[model samples]
Target: MASSTTRPDVETAAPSARVAGRLLDSSAKLSYDPLTEVDWETPLDTDFHGASPEWSTLYGTSYWDELTEAQRKELTRHEAASVASTGIWFEMILQQLILRDVYAKDPGDDAVQWALTEIADECRHSIMFARGAKKLGAPAYRPRRVAVELGRAFKTLAFGEAAYAAILVAEEVLDVMQRDWMRDERVVPFVRTINNIHVVEESRHMKFARDETRKNLAKAGPVRRHIHAFVIAVAAYVIVTSMVNKGVYANAGLDPERALAAARSNEHHKAMMRSSCSGLMDFLASARLLTKPALAFYKRAHLI
Candidate 1:
C-alpha cells in the first residue's frame, strides 16, 4: 500500500520536475554574471539613448517633439534608470515570495532547487540594476509610498497562484520592452547588454512562473480563483504605474509638472503598452485569470 501511494505521488510530480531540470541545465549552459558581462567601466555615452526612443513614456507627446535631441537622450537615460530601479523592487518582492513558498519543502526536489536558483539570479539582478542606475547618474528611484506599503503586504501574505501570477505579470511586462531595447542600435551599448542578459535569463523565470501558476490554479476552487485574480490584477497595476518614476522627469532637466501631465495622457504610450502586452493578456485569459475585475485593472493600467 505504501509503495503504491508513493509511486502515484512521484508520477504526479514528474512534469514539473522535468521542467525544473531543464531550466537548471539551461542556466548552467548560459547564465550571465552581470558584473562581468556588462561594460561597467565604460563611461555613460550621451550620444546614445538609454532605451529605444519608441519605448519612452513621453515619446509622442508635444513635449517630446519640442525637446532637442540631447534633451530626448537625457530623458530616456533617466527613464531607463527608473525602470531598472523598479525592476529591483519587484525582483525583491518575488524573491521573498518564492523563498516563503519553498520553505521546508524537500531540498532535493528539482522544483525547490530551481526556486533557489531563481532567487540567486534575482539577487544578482538587483545588484546589477543598482550599479547600472548609478552609472546612468540617476538617483535611487523608489516606488510611491502607497505602492511600497502595498507590495510589503502582498509579498508577505500572497501564496500559490496569486504569488506566481503576479510574478509572471511583472516579468512579462518588462520582457516586451527589454526585447525591443536590446535589439535597437540607438540604445547605449552597456544598457543593451544589460537588457540582453535580462531577456535571456528572465525567459526561464517566466516559464517557471507560468507553469507554477497553472499548477496551483488547477487546485483552486472558483472562489479562490476569483480572489487571486483580483489580487494579481492589483499587483499588476501597481507594478506598471511604478515603472518610470516621476522624479525621472526632473532628473532629466524637464519640468516635472509638464512632463507628468503629458505622460499621463500619452496615447502613443498607451497603445504601445496594449500592443506589447497582448501575449501576456492572452496567457492570462487562457488561464482564466482574466476575470472582469482583472480585465478592468489591466485596462486601467493600459496593459490590455
Candidate 2:
C-alpha cells in the first residue's frame, strides 16, 4: 500500500514563541534604581594613593608626551571607556539587589548566600573605577539618559525574577571579560592597583555566577523555560557588548574602530579574553547551560 513513501507524511511545526515573549517580558522589569546598599559613610582614604612615578616610565613619559595630541586624546578616551565599563558593572549590581528582593519572594532552598558578599564587592568596584577615572583626569561619568529609559521600560514588566536573571547574565559575562583584560595588561602601579583590586574581587563574583546560574537552570524543567533563560542571557550579552561599540569608546576621543582593533589584536587582550570569556563558556557548557542551540546562537553572535 506504501509507495516509496512508507513514512507517514509529517508536518513540521513552528517553534512556539511563548518562551521568547516571556523572556522579553521578564527583561522589562529592570528599572535603574539608585544603589542604596553601599556604606558611603565609610571613609575612602586609600582611594587617593596615587600611582608611582615609575609607572610613567613604562609608557615612556618622554615618548608619551611626544605623541600627537590625538594620541594623548586617546588616553582620555580609554579612561572614559573604563568608567563606562564599570558603570555597566554597577548597573548589574543594582539589578542583583532587585533580584535579591524578587528571589526572596520564593527563595530557593540552596540559593547562594554569596550574592550579598558580591554586592559589597561590586560597590567597591564601582567606587574604584570612578576614582580611577578621576585620577586620570576624566570627568565623573553620569548615567546616560538611555539607561534611565531602559530601566523605566523594564520596570513596567511584572515578572521581576526573569528580568533580574537577564541582567545577571549581562553583568557576569562583562565582569568575566574585565578580569581577563586586567590580568593581561602590564600597566604602571596606579592602574595596576585598580586592576588588581577588581580582578581579585571579580574572580569570586564570576564563580558565584556559575554556581547561581547552575542552580537556576537545575530548577528549570520545561523546554520553554530553558529557552526563555537562553533568550534573556543572549539579550544581556547584547546590551553589554553594545555599550562597548557605542559611545563608550567614541566619547573618550579614541577612534572606536582603531581601539577595537587594538583591543582585538593586542596580545594581552587576547590572553585575557581567552582566560576569562573562554573559561566562562566552558564552565557553562560543562554545566549544560550551553546546549547545542545555545552554542549555535553564540557562534552566530560572534561570542564564541
Candidate 3:
C-alpha cells in the first residue's frame, strides 16, 4: 500500500472488527483445501471445456465460425489456462497489497487476522490455478510486460480505496466468470472444482474490499478521492486487459496475429464483460468513483 498516512480505513475499529469477525468465522466454517478437495487424479478429459465457451475472447468472432468443434474446445482450454495464470498473477499482487495494508497493525485484531487468512486463501488459490492450467496442457502464461511492471508499482504504492476498489473489481470480474464455469456441465470437473473454490472463498474477500473502499472514501477529501478514483479505473483497465494472455491463441494452434485481431474486435466478448460487471459498476458509481476521467478508462476497457 501507499504511505501509512494515506490509510485512514485501518485506524478505525468498531465496523472493521464486525466485518472481520464475520469473515474469519465464516472462513473457518466453509473454506476449502484445493489440494485434497479437487479431483485432480482423474485423467484430463478432452471432451470437456476448461470454462464456458461464451467466456472465450474469440467466441463470436468470424474465426470462431471457421473452427471445428475440436478446435473451439482447444481454444477455450488454452483461454481458460491463460485466465488461471492471470488469476495467479493478480492474486500475488493482491496478497502483497493487502499484507502491506495491514503491516504493523495489531496482529490479534480480527481485521488483521482476516487479512492474513485472506492471504493464505490466495496462496492456496494460486497453487490450484497453476495446477489446473498445467492439467489443461497449457504452458505458463504471463501478462504483458507493461502490465507486469505496472502491477509491481501499484501493489507497492496504492492505498486506501484505490487498492481496495481495484481488488473488488478484479474479484468481481473473476467471480462472475468463474460462477459460470463452476456450474457449466461442459467444463472439466477438476477445473469446475477450482472455480467453485475460488468463487466461494473470494465472496468474503469481496465483501471486505467493498467495506474497506467505503470506509476509506468516507475519510478521503474531494481532491484525494478524485485522484484515487482515476487510479482505480486505470488499474481496472490494466487488469481486464491482462486477463487473457496473448500467447493463448498461438498455444491453442490458431494463427496468433489473426486470432489477436479477431479477439480485439470481438463485440460479443466486450458486451459480455459489460453485462457481467453491471453490479460492480453500480458499486463504483455509488462510491462516486465513476468520475468522467475514470469512466473513460472503464469505457475503453469495455467494462461499462
Each candidate: RMSD = 5.2, 15.5, 5.6
In order of TM-score, best first, we have 1, 3, 2
For all candidates in order, the CA lDDT equals: 0.93, 0.45, 0.93
Error of 1 at 137 (Å): 0.9
Weakest lDDT window of 10 consecutive positions for candidate 2: 49-58
Candidate 1 per-residue lDDT, tens place, 109-215, comes to: 88999999999999999998899889888899999999999999999999999999999999998999999999999999999999999999999999999999999
Clashes of each: 0, 3, 0
Distance from true location, Cα of 94 in model 3, Å: 0.7
Highest-scoring model, TM-score: 1
- In the predicted model 2, the residue pairs found to clash are 28-154, 29-154, 77-252
Candidate 3 residues lying further than 4 Å off, grouped into runs, are 1-13
Badly placed stretches (over 4 Å) of model 1 are: 1-13
Residue 170 in model 1: lDDT = 96
Q: What TM-score does structure 1 among the candidates reach?
A: 0.95
The residue-by-residue lDDT of candidate 3 on 1-304, one tens digit each, is 1122323343365877888877877787788999999988998989998889999999988899999888888989999999899999999999999999999999988889999999999999999999999999999999999999999999999999999999999999999999999999999899999999999999999999999999999999999999999999999999999989888888889999999999999999999999989999999999999999999999999999
Q: Candidate 2 vs candidate 3: which has greater lDDT?
A: 3
